[model samples]
Target chain A: AQSVTQPDIHITVSEGASLELRCNYSYGATPYLFWYVQSPGQGLQLLLKYFSGDTLVQGIKGFEAEFKRSQSSFNLRKPSVHWSDAAEYFCALNSGGGADGLTFGKGTHLIIQP
Target chain B: DTAVSQTPKYLVTQMGNDKSIKCEQNLGHDTMYWYKQDSKKFLKIMFSYNNKELIINETVPNRFSPKSPDKAHLNLHINSLELGDSAVYFCASSHRLDTQYFGPGTRLTVL
Candidate 1:
């Protein structure tokens, strides 16, 4: 079964500091990867996605992720995170096909210290 | 205009009762999905419909039925709701297997 692992349950970073959220997936073949952010009491917003394209993919709110096939990882990174960036970050994978649903990680709670 | 929306942002119901959550998307997407977010914030896909046709039912219980009235609307009906059913439900839509846009979510609390 395809699964996602987000090692960090929670991460704390100072405002305006760089941020990186780790994500690893277990799948038989290369799958579609995505990053989503959910603010408190709100729905999730797609930050970015990786299909068949350049390894490094950029997303909204200055977020970016790199799909390293060899590493089986799709880590989200931000040059500088604002306080508004503090939210739950989830890494998801879809193994193609219309019947397949996105397998999401446990999610990492980002806390931006002001 | 909201791209995707779910009715009744909050719902409180008693166990064994029946309830429904409605979802609609104006993005003209062909696929609609239902996801459950537990208390731990673990999100899982319960069902997916493509063009009003059920395509994915991820071993969800029969008590939880998803009805896609049309290509733009998908509703989830829960029967005999249990305490464990208390969580946030999200509706999402996309163009086939493309990026999905999500609704604000409905928080269901079964007491």
Candidate 2:
């Protein structure tokens, strides 16, 4: 079974500072990757997805992630984060089939410091 | 318009009681899924239906049953609910195997 591992349980970044959240996946083949953000008491919102492309994918809210096949990682990055970016971010994966559904990480709690 | 919606945003019930949470999606997607988010914010897929047929059923207990009356609707019914079953249940839909759109989620609190 495919699984996602987010090494960071919580990360704090100052406003206007760059942030990076590490995510690694264990899948046999090339997998579909996604990043989702959820605010307090809210549903998961898609940040971005990576199917097959240039490895670097940009998502909503000025967030981006790079899929490094050799590293088995798809880490989300933001050059400058705002206070509104403080939320729970999840890394997910799917093996490209309805049956596979999606395997999600435990999530990283992003805390923006002023 | 909400792409995916789940009814009873907050549910408070006692143990051993039966409850149901309804989910509907207007995206006309062919696949729908149920996921549970625990207190620690760990999300896991429980069930999935494709065109009203069960496509994926995870290692969930038998007390939790999913009913898909149509392609656009998938409802979850829990019988004899336990305290461990208290969590946020999310409904998601997608066109085949693409990115999924999630509902607002139903928070179930079992007393």
Candidate 3:
């Protein structure tokens, strides 16, 4: 079965520091990869997505993700983290057509320190 | 304007009660989905509808049913809700094989 894995359960980073959240996926074929963030008491927001385009994809809130095919990974990163960036980050993937639902990872809890 | 929206942002109900959560998307997308986030913050897909037709249904309980009256609307109805059903439910919509837009989500608490 296809699955998504977010290795870190919790990551603490000081504000203004660089950050990286690891993600790995298992699928039969090249899959559609995505990164989503959810703030406390909020819905999931799309951070970035990797389709058939360039390996590097940029998203809102100064977030970017790189999709590596050989490693089967799509990792999210930011140059300078902000206090507002603390939230639950999820990595997801879908292998089929548009009708197929996404398989999400357990998610990583990001804690921003001042 | 909200691209996708869900009604009853917070719902508190007793076990065995039946309730419904409505969702609508104005992005003109033909596909809508329901995802459940547990207390542990683990998210899972529950159902998917494409153009008012059921396309994907996970290993969800029979008490849970999804109704898509039209392409722009999808509603989830839960019968005999249990305490284990307490979780946040999100509604999302997407065009064919494209990025999906998510709603604000509905938090359901069954006591």
- Which candidate number maximizes DockQ? 3
lDDT of 1 by residue, B24-82 (tens): 99999999999999999999999999877889888778999999889999999999999
Minimum summed lDDT over a 10-residue window in model 2 chain B is located at B49-58
| Model 3 per-residue lDDT tens digits across residues A1-114 | 999999999999999999999999999899999999999998888999998889999999999999999999999999999999999999999886658988999999999999
* Candidate 2 local lDDT, B44-99, one digit each (tens): 99999987889888899999999999988999999999999999999999998799
In order, the candidates keep a fraction of the true contacts of 0.76, 0.76, 0.88
Model 1 misplaced stretches (Cα beyond 4 Å): none
Cα lDDT, model 1, residue B15: 99
Which regions of candidate 2 are displaced past 4 Å? none
For candidate 2, the chain B TM-score comes to 0.99
Docking class of 1: high
By the DockQ metric, which is better: model 1 or model 2?
2
Candidates' DockQ values? 0.80, 0.81, 0.84
Worst 10 residues of 3 chain A by lDDT: A94-103
* Local error of candidate 3 at residue B26 (angstroms): 0.5
Worst window of 10 by summed lDDT in candidate 2 chain A: A94-103
Candidate 3 per-residue lDDT over residues B12-69, each given as its tens digit: 9999999999999999999999999999999899999997889989999999999998
lDDT of 1 at A24: 100
In order, how many clashes per candidate? 0, 0, 0
